[model samples]
Structure formats: C-alpha cells, structure tokens
Target: MTTKTSQGRFFEDYRLGETIAHAIPRTLSGGERALYHALYPSRFALTSSDEFARACGLPAAPLDGLIAFHTVFGKSVPDISLNAVANLGYGEGHFRRSVHPGDTLRAESEVIGLRQNSNGKSGVVWVRTSGRNQRDEVVLDYVRWVMVRKGDFDAPAPPPHIPTLAATVKAADLRVPKGLDFSAYDFGQAGEPYRWGDYAVGEMIDHVDGVTIEEAEHMMATRLWQNTARVHFDATLRPDGKRLIYGGHVISIARALSFNGLANVQLIVGLNAGAHANPCFAGDTVTAWSEVLDKAETAVPGVGALRLRLVARKGGAPFRLRGEDGTYLPEVLLDLDYWALVPN
Candidate 1:
C-alpha cells in the first residue's frame, strides 16, 4: 500500500535526537551550470571559463558554492520544516569541499536540539545537516532550527543546543575556491567596480525583474541538485499531474535577482538561515527583493561585508513582505539570511 499522504506539514512531527533522511538524490549537469551563470550573471571568470579555471589551477569550471549549498539545503525542506513557523538561525556552517558537475549530491539530517514553546502549541527543532557528493565526500555542513508543531503535547521536549553563531565571518574564514587567482581577474568584464565599502547596514532594495519558468528548466535543476524527489520533476508522481518545482531553483533565482542591489557582493561569508516560504511551480514569474541585515570588514583590500535577506515572490506590486495578519506574507517563497563580501 502506498503511504503517501501530504496536506502540507505542521510543527508536530519532528523528534529530538532522531534522524530524518530526506529522500531523493540529485545529479547536477551542464544544463544546471548554464542556468546558474545565466541567473546570476556572476563574473567570477573561474566559473565561466574552463580556460581561466585551468590557468588558475582547477580541473574545470566549478559550480557556484552557493549553488551547491542551496542544492544540499533544499533537500531537507520536505522532511524537516514544510510546516515550520520560523527558521531560527544557522551555525557551524563550513564548506569542506567543492562539488563539480556530474557529481550526485545527497543529504541527511540529525536532529540535535528541540524546545517546546511554553504555550505548548509549537516548539523549535534543531538539526545539523550534512551534504555529501556521490563519492561520499563532505561538501557542506551546517546547523539550522525551525519552529515545529508538537506531534504529541505529551511527548517530552527535546533538549535545546543553540550553538553560538558568528554575527559576521572574517575574510580569513572564507574558503576561497581553490585555484581562484584574482591576480589575473578581469574587473572590467566582471560587471561592477563597486567594492566592499559600498554597502551599509539596514539598507533594503528591490531587485525589480521577473523570469517565467518552464518545465525543462526546473526538471533540469532538480536533477542537478541530485534531488531525485519525483515531485520536483515527474508529472506522474503526484495525483494532480503537476511538476513540483526544485527549491534550489528558487534559491539561485533569488540570489541572482538580489544582484540588482547586491551587485558588488563578492564572496559569501555566512548563512544564518533560509526558508522556501511557499511552493513554486512552472510558469511562475519570480521576482526578488533584499534587505541588509548587518555589515563587517573582510581582510581583503577594498572588500566590505554585507549581510542580506533575499526574498522571492510570484507576481504583483513591487511591494515588500508582510501578511494580511501583519505577518510575513505566505506568498513569499523564501527567507534566506546570509553574508557576502562586497566592495569597500
């Protein structure tokens, strides 16, 4: 008998100290690489040219580290926080290795902490998730928490381990992708001249634009993330015959759209937390907006630091986020908090 029954998740299912393995393995390909560059317009030549990469000392152009992070993180959504009330924060994030095309990625989560709300209705669930490539090599590791419903109010609340997270990562903490030689970097063709100092804390900007998605686009993305979940591609997987969208696609699109205002964001330093606030499907016109959360200084000359929140939505007035109830709107598809290095 098929045991598939989903009407959206609520906070009650997570168990502290228990592990939940997210199904679906994804295998990224050239198509995803192409889409990633197109979406972000990133000028990190190493990602755009094999020749440049060879000169810098890599086997070939590598996928964006953010792309790999998004792919790995997106895999946990369904099993962990589909019904989450809020993403608490992220900690212990480190990229242990690089993932290239043709590499299949799989993810697993270990619940490390849990705390029931005093009201007894909902609680926080924390997990340290690790993403691994086909070779079983670690690609990334991070901690995240979400407010979930109690499966049973009588169930004892799990212990909470809210690890201390850095407010801003130093440039020395950056894992500059190997073989990346900025010495030969082309700033003119790299897109923008604004370095780190250009950004300030608490600033907000709307990246005004939209890109209509197609089936081929999403299916390819789902596959690249090695997220084999049928919902993201197979039309027959669901009763409605609708192709489920890949969460990573939304992440990449939103990050790319964030470029409008975060154009000078040179390096990603920290990932505080993230969420796909809602489901996304084909034919959806995705748009993006950003808010500066914090700022810091990196060791690199002329490099500044900016923490940003990037949100993606379907369509409508270029308005900011808020629900009718004064909460963040449900139409919002993402709530990603991360840090980037920009021009000083």
Candidate 2:
C-alpha cells in the first residue's frame, strides 16, 4: 500500500531557491466583485460603477486590487503556509497591472530566505510570490515571511538566509494604469471633492466607523480565497479555541472604512510594508485611521500619488501606534503603508 496525501510543507522541508507552482488557477468574474463589496463597506466609485471607470478613461472597472492579492495569497497557502504558525509581514509589493473580471490568474512562489527559531519548534520562511494572468503578465508581486512549525524537532536546521527588502516602493516605480486621466474627474459622482493637493503630509483622518467581525463572514471570506490555513478554520488549532480572522479581511475592511476620508483614492498602486501587529479574531470591532506620510506627482496628467499609513485598531484612540518600548500597542491590529492614486 502507498500513502498519497499531503501534510503540507513544514519548516524543515523547505529549501532555499526552490520555486513552487501553486495549485488552482482561478478565473474571476463580476460575481467576485459583488461578493467582495458585500463582505466589506467598499464604495470606491471607480470600482463600483462602469460609467465612472469609463469616465476616468479605463475601458471598464477593474476589480479591487486586493481581490487579485487575496486570490494569489490563497493559492499559496497550501504550498507555503499550510503548517504555519503565522503569516508575519509583507514588503516590496506592487500592483503591476490592473486585474479585470474574466481574467484567469495563477501564482508561483520562490523560497528566498530561511531562518530557524531557537525554540526548535518553529522557523521562518520567506518567499517572493508572483501572481500572473493567462497572458503571463505579472499582476501582483510581493515578499512575505511566515513562521512555520517544524514537524521534527531533531531535524538539523539549515543555515539562516534573510533577504534585504525595500522600505518603500518608489513613486517612479508605481504603475499607473494606462488612460487613467482625472482631468475631468467628477467630484460629485465620486462622492468627494478632495483631490491630491487637498491632503497634506502629517495630517491624520479618523474614519470614525467600526465593523465587528462575524464568524460566518470570516469563514466565507477565507473559503472564497481558497485559504486553507488551519488556524483560521479549525477551532482546536489554537489554545483559545477561536478562529482567527484572516489578516486580508482586516485590510479590506480598513480600506473600505477609509472611504469616509479617502474617497478619491481610487487605486492602490504600491504596498511599501505591512504587519499583522496583533492577531484578530471573531467578535473584534475593527476601526481605522490614516496619516499622510508623503506625496508625489505622477506622469499622468491630473493624477498624483499619496503615501499613507493606514492603521487598524480594535480599541484605543487614533494616532497612537507604538508604545514607549517601540512596539505596537495592544490595541493595534494592523500597520500598513502604501501608495494610492488620486486626482490632482
């Protein structure tokens, strides 16, 4: 008899420089967009209406950038994080192209670095994953590191290798969609009059809204993305006996809530860095706020970029991020820095 089953790749099983082609190629449709909007408070005009997108010069509305991201991230779960402790952090992420409905997407990952924990029970694995469309055009790419459990404690650890990553994706490197012109952008249709120039560096905006995570919705979102992480689905996987809400869920929720103050930020073009500062579980009420970190002009007429720090917290006052020890406070759930395109 032969055993044919996958227990997923443990820390000791990974080898640096190896590439893994993830399983399942997903073809997205407008239904995905509808479900995504239903799952969160997303209301970006460009993605919400075809007419608005056409008015902005795009042939049609593109799916939310995170939809591509989560799909790719989900495909990698079985091969990358099926036996993981936590998905730690992300860096050097860029949305190279707009993803539209009817496009089929797939993902592959290269193990870029590795480091074993002193505890001998777990280790970190870093990978650069690329999501591509049917035409082989890269849609999204990013580096992520996850802490994975070591199946065999006695297995010899590999020499540690950590990769250097960029602190931010430069404005020059951002890819503004072709034909995206905000010259005649309708502030009335967009639901906001604020433009790129209206925002100032160092200014903070409190979203002033909160959404409680429900067990059912979280489960649906994880399954929708094909994320098979045990901690997110199996109650017995954690000592607390509560399912962990997917971090992307928190990100989408925060981004949607930001519509209150950032209605004109129609596209997320670059992701500088992100961290799941703390674990989020069902029943947690998530709130968000944003601070303008920097701003730049794009070559596209009427388009500019804003570097923002979007922080999501379970509780506590806005603008308070780190503590005296230089670590995230207990209330902080996410600290994400990214660049978005807005009208000039």
Candidate 3:
C-alpha cells in the first residue's frame, strides 16, 4: 500500500537561510471588503468610501490593513507554521503599498533564525515574510516567529541563530504611498478632528467599545484568509475541547474598536511589535485602548507619524497592562506597538 498525504514540515525540516516561495496567489475583491465589515466594526472613512479616498489623493479605498496582513500571513502557514504549537509574535512590519480591490497577492519567506526549546519537544522558527502584488511590488513585509512541534523529539537540535531584530521600525523607513496627500482631508467626513499634531505623546484613550467573539464569525474570517491553522477550527486539537481564536482576529477587532478614539489616523504604515499575550476564545468580550508613545514629522507634504501602543483586554481595569511581576495581566490579550500616518 502507498500513502500520498503530506503532513506539513516539522521543526527538523527547517534550516536557517532557506527561502520559501509560498503558493496560491489570491486576488482580492469587494467580497473581502464586505466580509470584513460584517465580521468587525470597521468604519474608517477612507476605507469606507472611494470618494473619501480620492479626496485624500488615493485612487480608491484600500483594503483594511488587517486584511492585507491576514492574506500575507495565510500564504505562509503551510510552509511555516502548519504543525505549530503556537503563533508566537510579530515584529518590524510595514506596508509599502496600499492594496486595492482586484489586486493579486502572493507571499515569500526566508528563514532567518532558529532556537531549540529546553523541553526538546518543540523549537521556535523565525522568518521574515514579504507579501507582493501582481506587479511584483511588495505591499507588506514583516518578521514573525512561531513555536513549532518536532516530529521526532530525539532529533538533534539545530544550532541557535536568533537574529537581532529592531525593537521599532524607524519613522524614516515608513512608506507613505505615492500621491497620498492629506492637505485636503475633511475632518468631519473622516469622523475625527484629531490629526497628527493633535495627539500628544503619553496620552491614553480608552476606546469604550466591546465585541463578543462568535464561533461562526471567526471560522468565516479564517476561511476567508485561507488560514489553515488547525487549532482555530478543530476543537479536539486541544485537551480543553475548545477551538482557539486566531490572533489576527483579535488584532482586527482591536483595531476596529480603536477607531472611536483614533478616527483620523488614516494609514497603518509600521508595526513595530506585537504579542498575543493570552489565548482568546469565543464568548470573550474584547475591548481596546491606545497610548501615544511617540511622534515624528514625515517628508510627505501633509503627513505625520504617530507611534502608539494599542492594547486589547477583557474584564480588566482600563489602561492596565502588566501586573506586579512585569508580565501581562491575565485579562490582557494583545499588546501592539505600531505607527500610523495622519494629517499633520
């Protein structure tokens, strides 16, 4: 008898410096926009109206930043984290170009670092992945690390080669899209009067909105992104008999909730760091808040950058993050530091 089923790559199959060209190019469309709005409470004016986008000097409304992130992340799952224990963290992310409807996207990754866990049952693999459009232009680029299970626990561990990643993406490295002008931006139409100059560092805003996660919505979102992580869909995968929610799902909802406070924050240009501090499951009501970390002027005519720390939590006092020991509180689900573009 012959069996012909691939079980995906285990920790032993990975090597530093290996370049993987992920398969299955996806062409996005209006359907994605519709589904995203249905799944989350996204109401950013620029992404909601073509006319609003045009006034901001864009040809059309670009897909939500998280949609572009999920598409790129999904393509690398099979090659990178199909047999993963957990998707660990993200760092140094940037959107180089806006993704519009009808654009085809693909992904490629290069293994940059590796480390064997002390338990010897799993290892962490770090890869820098790039999502490119049909024009072969990179739309998104980021580095993420995942903890993957080892098919053979007895296999010799690979020498550790952890790369020194930057703690934050430099403001100068941020990509302001070509012809992106906010001089004519309308505050009323955009739903917020705050601009780059209006936000001061050290200020915190509690986005007082919450959304309870639903099983059906998460499944639909995972399928939409073509994400094949078993833990997100298979209840039997864990001993708890509950399906794990995708981290990106938490990110999108948190970002959507932030709109109430960060209404005029237009483009997500850089993701400096992020961590899924705790597991999020269905029925958990998620809320978010943001702290202005830093600010910088951009070379763009009317654009500026605001560095922020976006936090997602459940059932916690507002603005609380870490506990006494300097670790994230049990109620905290995500801690993301990023930079967004706004009109100066």
Error of 3 at 16 (Å): 0.4
Error of 1 at 256 (Å): 2.1
TM-score of each: 0.68, 0.99, 0.99
Q: Is candidate 1 or candidate 2 better by lDDT?
A: 2
> Residue 120's C-alpha lDDT in candidate 2?
94
Which of candidates 2 and 3 reaches a greater lDDT? Answer: 2
Residue 44 miss distance in model 2 (angstroms): 0.3
What's the alpha carbon RMSD for model 2?
0.7
Candidate 2 regions off by >4 Å? none
lDDT of 2 at 57: 97
- Residue-wise C-alpha lDDT for candidate 2, range 253-305, written one tens digit per residue: 99999999999999999999999999999999999999999999998989999
lDDT of 1 by residue, 1-344 (tens): 77687744445566556777777778977777787776544455545667756654568877777777878777887777655544555666766666788998888998877677888878887888988998888788888776766656676655555545555444356554554444454455446665555555666788887777788877766655555444665577567788767666777777777666665564565676676667778888889888878777555544556778888888855556776677667667777877665545
Candidate 2 clash total?
0
